[model samples]
Target: MPPADGPSAPPGGDEVDRIVAAWRRVAPDLDVEPLEVLSRVARLAHHLDRLRRGAFAAHELETWEFDVLAALRRAGGTHELSPGQLVVQTLVTSGTMTNRVDRLERRGLVQRRPAPDDGRSVLVRLTPAGATVVDAALADLVRAEHRMLAVLPAGERRALAALLRRVTAPFETTARG
Candidate 1:
């Protein structure tokens, strides 16, 4: 099926088109518009997830490791955040975050230190090794995503990004509230 915007045909549109066609045949009156866009998004997400996993694995890191390392790396100079802050940034439960920190510490990818402002709380800092691995994994993931988007021209890619932002912004805005 042709994309709502862009070229006359999708780069590899067999499955969505076939599925949509079957739905139309079985239920001609039903509006399957949502299926077209959402099904493709789900499939693309699955593909992207696999690509990211492979990219991280190539650097000897898991998705959780990359997530925690990235949060600390983005914290800048000190390259550290309290466990509470990491939990917020990584969107994991505090218990899960602690487990992740423990594993990363064991791997020598991160270190823990007492928070200067609050003696009872600790900070998780990215070690040199963690920064190196996360950075490489992020670079690989970007390259892989770019390759996956090769079918779209620059203008169409921008348009699609804008469209997706419109679709996602509501959920994000609601979450912040």
Candidate 2:
């Protein structure tokens, strides 16, 4: 019988289960706990990426474009960030950020203006059109995510997030270091 709170494992079923069993049979000495969790995480990320791409596309925005626009949108009321700052937020290379800014500028979604305080520096500002589209895309994305997470109860969801954060913290810390 399945547990009332979570998914049930049917006899000799579930893809993850099958994979784990196969690995155990092939390499019984190896610890596969990380694979069991991380594999699912990777798969989930792939699906989420597709879902997010679809949601953003509905607003006539590609994922990369949305990432830049949303980063600017979240940068307080000014809705602008230096390309260097954007590179940090979006985790793209300097050249990539420059290209993104250029594309967005051409699309009338963003503009490059001389920084007020730093005469030599330029800031990428989200235009009204960019803000409108990004905002709509964000709303749609959130709705879709909420629907996907609806499978878990509030308490379980919180616990899952905490657990995942704990598992992921080391990687984030290492990257920062």
Clash count of each predicted structure: 0, 0
Q: CA lDDT of each candidate?
A: 0.89, 0.89
Q: On residues 1-177, what C-alpha lDDT tens digit does candidate 1 reach at each position? A: 535432332356668877876777678899998999999999999998899899999999888889999999999998999998898888889999999999999999999999898898898999999888888889999999999999999999999999999999998888656
Per-prediction TM-score: 0.88, 0.90
**Candidate 1, superposed: residue stretches over 4 Å from native:** 1-13
Flag clash pairs in model 2. Answer: none
* 136 Cα displacement, candidate 2 (Å): 0.4
Error of 1 at 36 (Å): 0.6
Residue 29 lDDT, candidate 2, scale 0-100: 98
Candidate 1's displacement at residue 108, Å, is 0.8
Candidate 2 lDDT over 63-100, as tens digits, reads: 99999999999997889999998998888899999998
